[model samples]
Target chain A: MYSYSEFDEAFVRERVSQFRAQVERRIDGSLTEDEFKPLRLMNGLYLQLHAYMLRVAIPYGTLAPHQMRQLAMIAERWDKGYGHFTTRQNIQFNWPKLKDVPDILDALADVEMHAIQTSGNTIRNVTADHFAGAAADEIADPRPVAELLRQWSTDHPEFQFLPRKFKIAITGSPNDRAVTKAHDIGLRMVRNEAGEEGFEVIVGGGLGRTPMIGKVIREFLPREDLLPYVEAIVSVWNLLGRRDNKFKARIKITVHEHGIEEIRRLVEDRFTEIRPGFSGVDQEVLAGLEAAFARPSLPERSLGGFESAYTNDPVFRAWSDTNVAEHAVPGYGIVTISLKAHGKTPGDASADQMRLMADLAEELGHSEIRISHEQNVILPHVHKSDLPRVHAALKEAGLGTANVGLASDIIACPGMDYCALATARSIPIAQEIAERVDELKIEHEVGHLKIKISGCINACGHHHVGHIGILGLDRAGVENYQITLGGDGTESASIGERAGPGFSADQIVPAIERLILAYLDLRESDSETFIQSYRRLGPAPFKAALYPETAEKERADAA
Target chain B: MSRKFTPKVVTGNALIEGDAVWLTEDDRWTREMSEAELIEDEAHAQMRLLFGQSQPSVVVGVYLADAKAGLNGPEPTHFREDFRTRGPSNYPHGKQATA
Candidate 1:
């Protein structure tokens, strides 16, 4: 993790003081609500349905344990004793008082984190693969590149007020855990034909009312040219993007309206013009950023305790099987502590749990904690010798739901329950599904599933990419859930197809239950996942499972 | 003839605390939806909403929400408003947390 330089610290402190004065001006009645709205949003404060929500940026999903502890402190002091980790790799404090926001900003500055660029039509947090540095398949850590992008994009004057919000995700590995395909700009580190590492630049991918898989603007951009090339893409979109309609303002729509080839041509033209402005200073910054990320390496360690725990303890073995991912280091493993405990709110970590994780990260892990886009916390570089201890601590803290990629590990956005834009509640629906899945004890058996729920069509929960996507809507004043099938968010990203008529709030859980059970029966073997089964046989079987009543009516009609 | 207007109440989130609040007939912002002034006429609802919006320092994002005459005062018709009456269903932290 990169510690903030004196300059960086000064910049953040200045921003905080400016926001504090702005907040004071608003409270003192000098600034109108309309005037204060943008200022507050610029500081990542939003008046949500039930309360004021403060979104704090977690750059590249990486957190030093001390930073994590500071976050815990903020949650305990000013928030509702908990923080919700969003799908965008940010933490939102839901119950922040307006008067306390400036204090919160000041506190965040203390830890070199800020809420800047979290909202407004600006470049938001730059997220990366949670397992970036530790993943066995990664060629290099993507955080340095992500950090460089973060620095370049933060408060950049020319691009601050673009047509709409922009997001960028980067990953080091070919297997895209960063959901690169679903971002406005996705950068995947790849090796060129010459065996030199470069980036496969993807642009215009987003999910909302309109879901798009980002187009490959640059198939293989040289490592040194990343900053300039990315700048060109955003610059092209800033000028050409539609400002008329909010829905059509995203770069994804721009790409859709203007062909990718034409867009690429414009980007190349812009790259030529602006490439000189960089003057290789970005390279110097990137080199310094890379060195800052050179944390103590995960040296090989004895795995005897780990092996014995795996063999002897069924509980530990189950958790290890579900939550652990292979690390690049010989004896280390990446542990994703599932926040999606069955029947509990997904992605929410209590202040105590956050503190515990911070302490555990310092003690057992390499003092590094990562917040995954899946809403789980990651100890990306934990030695196998420490896995049992880490798991034990997490288990004791009620953070030991061993369902990382399983059916019960669902991603649900804060629907009508908290969001003003939500048409219906999504949390209860997510809760019911997870509870049923756990009650059946077939989550592990049902195997590798991505169940995502969105409160609305905004798809903040990444519902468009789930194998079982549940979209909550309001119909005739009643809550309705529409299911989408066969959506994926990996290297092979595709928008999910809507299954059929929406189910009522009462019927949705049962509908999802039927769908999962059907997948279990339809699958060829345990190895076949829900997505694999769906792709192999198509939506017919899943639709039949989701709408058994309609399927029966159709059968009668055919008969 | 114009269609009869449904009952409505002026609502906004408290500026300082950000709690969901409804305007009472006595010109007070109350967190309790049951204490809200449910306007039967469309003109009264619009006026009440304007008044709510006027209190910029007291509230933010004022609007009229569909309401109905309840045993006490006003009851929300839409689920969104109903959710605001209570807090998020995921946890017991909102008004319903203790209720």
Candidate 2:
């Protein structure tokens, strides 16, 4: 994990002091709500449906045990004894008094953390692969680059107030766990023809009212030119991108309106103008950041004990099967702690649980923990020998869920329950659906299904990329949900198609059950997963299952 | 109607571990106070000053009220007594309590 340099520490401390004064001003009535809203948003504070929420950024999802413990302390002290981990790999305290937020930021700064850029139109936290440094197939670790970007983008004077919020994601490997292709700017490390590592830069991809898969503006950008090129792309967008309509303000909408070729031409022109300014200073800075991310040395050990433990313990075997993944190191494995326990609220961890995770991270695994964009925690460098003990500890702490990529692991936004913008309840609906799927005992058979729920068109839950997407809406003062099928979140990402009609909150669970059973019945064989069947057969069969009456009417017309 | 309001202590979720409270009488805080006293009527006045005016009235008690109802309705105050009475703060009251 990367430790904060003295400069970084001083910068955050200054920012905290600045915000404390701003809070005091707001309370004194010198700054009105209109004047105070933007300042609070810049610091990741929001007045939601019920209470104030303070979102703290876990930069690139990386955390030291002490940082994790600090988060637990915050929850215990200022919140409702728990924190909700968000899909963006950040944690949100759903309850905090306006007066105490400054104190919270101060406490976070003590641990070298802050909520800066976690919200607002500035470049939000730069996300990367959860298994970045540890993935066996990785060409290089992406976190060093992510950390470098974090340093450069933090309160960049020019880009602080973009037309809309910007997101950037990087991946070290081609497997694309970070969903790089679906971000404002996606950087994937790749090798050129000369066998030198560089980046394949993609721009304009995002999910919102308008969902777009990013277009590749540069096939391969040399590593040294990363910052200059990014500056060129953002500058081009800032000057030329539409500011007329809020809905059409994102770079994706600009790319859609002007066409990718034109956008590419503009970016190329901008890049040429700025390429001369690229100095060796960026390379030296990146080198320093890379040194900070030096991998932990593995102890000399054999995996014979791990093999025996897995064979003897069924629970450990199940966890190892689902949660453990191949590590870059021979004797180590990356362990994912699934927050989606069946029938419970997804992505919520009690203060006690957070403390327990911190202790376990220090004791059984490496002293580093990672939060995934999927809202799970990763003990990125656990030895194979420690798997059984870790699994036992996790089970006791209610964090040992054996569903990592499975169906019950749903990603939902803070819907009507918390978000004022939300039309219906997203979290409880996701909870109910997971509970139903568990009761049916068909999640294993369903196999790697992603069911995402968004409470509104804002699409914070990323419903557009789920195998089965549930969109909650308000209809005649009642909560209604719409279902979509065949959405994917991978190298081959696609927007899902909506099925027939929307169902009321009470009717949505059975509707989803019907859709799943229909897939089961129409599947070529049990070997085929829901996504495969949906893709191969298209929405016709799923639509038929959802609205048999419509299908019958169509058949009768054809007859 | 003019009614005398008693002094009480207001408590909320603590910063570190124990509890946070403010005393209504002195407009100061003492670490020592029972949870029961923290739920009294005058305790709420302190809560309003600390948390904000829009905080939900979870527990309320009064020495005087509408004579027809005999302490049934809430005690009269300078602010409106209607169910939909607005809070004093420019920002909505109780917005910070949820966080």
Candidate 3:
């Protein structure tokens, strides 16, 4: 992890002080509600349905043990002893009072973290692959570039108030774990013909009401040109994006109205205008940034215990199979502690769990933790020898659920439960579905399925990219859930297609069950995942399963 | 012929606690929706909303939401408003925890 420079420390401290004063002014009536809202939002504070929610950015989803402890302390002291990790690799404290929020911000600054640009139309927290530095298949650690982008975009006056909130994700690995194709701007690190690593820049991708896979505007951009080039893209959008209707304001909409070719031309023109101003200073910063992220070579450790545990314990074997991934370093593994334990709220970690993770990270793993966009915590560089012990600790803390990419690993937004913008409840639906799936005992058999549920069309849960997506809607004051199938959020990104009429909340879980059960029969083999089978067989079979009665009625009517 | 207007209540989140609160007929905020003052008339509902909005220090995002006068008090007509009354459903947190 990069230590904060004196300049960075001073900058964050100043922001905390400024926000403290702003809160005081708002309380004293010097600032009206209208005036205060944006100020609070800019500081990552939102007046949610039930309370003031403060979103704290975990830059590129990386956290030091000390930072994790601070987060736990904040959760215990100011919040409800829990924090909800969101899809954007951010943690949201749901019950921070307005007066206490400043203190929270100051505490965050103590650990070189701040909520700046976590909200508002500014370039939000620049997320990267959670397995960035540790992934076995990574071409290069993308966090240095992500960090460079974060430093460049933080309080950037020129792009602060865009037409709508902008999100950018970068993935160094070819596997695309960061869901790059679903962000406003997606940067996939790639090598050119010359064999120098650069970026394949994709723009116009978003997952709100209008879900889109970003189009590749640039085939390969030199690593040095990233900042200025991205600046140009946003600048083009800043000028052309609609400000009239909030719904039509995102850069994705602008890119949709104008073809990607035209947008690329405009961005290129803008890039040329600003290219001279950079003059290679960014390269200097990136060099320093890269050095900060360089991991010391780890001595190979014995994996005797790891092998013994995997063979000896069925529980450990199941967990290792699902929760652990290959690490770049030999004898090391990347562990994803499932936050989606059956019947628990997805993405939520208790304060005690946070402290436990911190302790484990310090003792066993490197003093590092990561929040995955899938709403799970990742100890990105854990030694394989320590796997059983870590698993035991996690089991004790109610964090061990051997269902990482399986059916129970669902992504659900804080729908009507806590989100003021939500039209219906999403959490309970997610909980019910997970419980149902666990009861059926087919989670492992389902194999590599991503079920995502969103409370509304806002698509906060990234429902558009799920293998099986569920969208909660308010139909004449009743909760209705619509299903979409074959949506994927990987290298082969595709938006799921809706399967006919929506089901009532009561009918949703059963509908999903029907779909999954149908996939089992439809798939060529057990190895063929739900997504592969869906692509091969199309949505017809799944749709038929979801609406069996309706299909039968239609067939009978036709007859 | 004019369509009959559904009942409504002036609702907003508390300024400090941020919990959902509804306006009473006597110009007070109550966390319980059951104690909320139900206004059948659109003009009265607008007036109540204005009154709720005026207290910027007390509440935020004041608006009129569809409701019906139950046997005890004002009941939410929409599922969203109902959720606002009873915190998140995933766990016993927020208002549900306290209530």
| Best candidate, lDDT | 3
Which residue runs does candidate 1 get wrong by more than 4 Å? none
Candidate with top DockQ is 1
lDDT of 2 by residue, A182-214 (tens): 899999999999999999999999887888888
lDDT (Cα, tens digit) per residue for candidate 3, span A1-559 = 7888898999999999999999999888889899999989889999888899999999999999999899999999998899999999999999899999999999999999999999888999999999989999999999999999998998898998899999999999999999999899999999999999999999999898999999999999999899999999999999999999899999888999999999999999999999999989889988999998987566798999999999999999999999999999899999999999999999999999999999999888778889999999999888898999999999999999999999989999999888878988889999999999999999998899999999999999999999999999988879999898889999999999998899998899998998889998998998999999999988888888998988899899999
TM-score of chain A of each: 0.99, 0.98, 0.99
Q: What TM-score does structure 3 among the candidates reach? A: 0.98
Q: Residue A128, candidate 2: how far off, in angstroms?
A: 0.6
If ranked by TM-score, best first, what sequence of candidates would result?
1, 3, 2
Lowest summed lDDT across 10 adjacent residues in model 2 chain A is found at A26-35
Quality of candidate 3 docking, DockQ? 0.84
Chain A TM-score of candidate 1 vs. true chain A? 0.99
Clashing pairs in 3: none
lDDT of 2 by residue, B31-68 (tens): 33321132235555545444432222221111111111
Q: Which residues of candidate 2, in runs, are more than 4 Å off?
A: A557-559, B1-99
Off by over 4 Å in 3: A557-559
Candidate 1 lDDT by residue in tens digits, A119-200: 9999999999999888999989999999999888988998889999999999999889999999999999999889999999
